[model samples]
Target: MANDLSLNKEQILDAAEQALKRYGPDKTSVVDVARALQVSHGTLYRHFASKAALREAVTERWLRRSIAEPLAQATGLPQGGSAAERLRLWLDTLIAAKRAHAAEDPELFAMYAAVTMEAAEMIDAHIDGLILQMASIIEDGITAGELRPGRPETIARAIFIATSRFHHPAHAREWNAERTDRDYDSVWELILAGLALPTA
Candidate 1:
């Protein structure tokens, strides 16, 4: 019975995600999800108290699949390359994942932004840990003389914020449309230039 209930919950959440993507969060409702899943409203409510709660669950699931999974995979990649190379690869992987997901379901991007604003401290902590892990990699580069000597945490925070600003549609639209990749490459070059060691 427990397993069956869990499966039902998963199905309902999946249905909710599809509905959100199609109708958007503001327009999506429990009735819409129930109709999509061919389940009764009572059954949907059995898994989630309300549409907002279900939306949160859907957004959380999307984050787990889209962001957490890719980060985990990147962490498992070979780490022997130059620190700068590894950092670039890691950032590129994250950016590519975001771009792909946004292309497939732009509504999901809006959902993520909303959830990030209202999510609990635990969620924020997890995000912080991800940032810190990236910073640790940059610190390794600095120690190896592949990057300049400075505060790794600060540098990491700056790069994360800067890259996010450049790639996020909210900010990127202000810049040239045809030159997004150029802008990204330039930003990365500037970051590396600031951090790379001066050859003797």
Candidate 2:
């Protein structure tokens, strides 16, 4: 409700997130966000350029928050575990976090997907981030000699694509099944088996 001229991008994004949650992405407009911030629509545009941009910002923030903490924990895997173990742990943690997000707030999760449909560039960037994170972990594994010599980026993409059913929004319904964990373990073991060097 603070209409101060000093309203910043974070403040606008916070207000826009609230608006999007309340009205869903399709109905939430720049005017709605402005009202939430007690500012004119023009004031909001000064920060976001347009409603689509504002929605993308809000969606991006949400997606980033979902992974930021877990991603750090994943990357900071303890020194004790082998690279294969660490990689599996990191992937499991990410998949769990994504599943929890969808399960905890079905409506908001659906709304986020709706916002994404209108923001192809943002979606692409998000996927790129996921792949990059996977690649970083793969590089760590290869450096530690637990993984075979191969292109980290290529392996990362393969892992991410194979695990899509667990993390991707379109597969949310499938992610809810009780057998999801078992299904993941099977896929993860297969990936690790492929990545690990053959024993003498």
The alpha-carbon lDDT assigned to residue 196 of candidate 2 equals 91
lDDT of 2 by residue, 1-200 (tens): 67666788888888877777778777988988888888887777778887778767877888888775567667776767777776777787788887887877776788676766778888888877877777887888888777898999899889988988888788888876899989988998888889998877
Off by over 4 Å in 1: 1-9, 34-47, 118-123, 172-176
Could you estimate the TM-score for every candidate? Answer: 0.78, 0.90
Cα lDDT of model 1 by residue, 161-196, tens digit: 878755454552343467878889999998888878
Clashing pairs in 1: 148-195
- The per-residue C-alpha lDDT of model 1 at residue 13 equals 80
In candidate 1 the C-alpha lDDT for residue 89 amounts to 85
Candidate 2 lDDT (Cα, 0 to 1)? 0.80
Estimate every model's Cα lDDT from 0 to 1. 0.74, 0.80
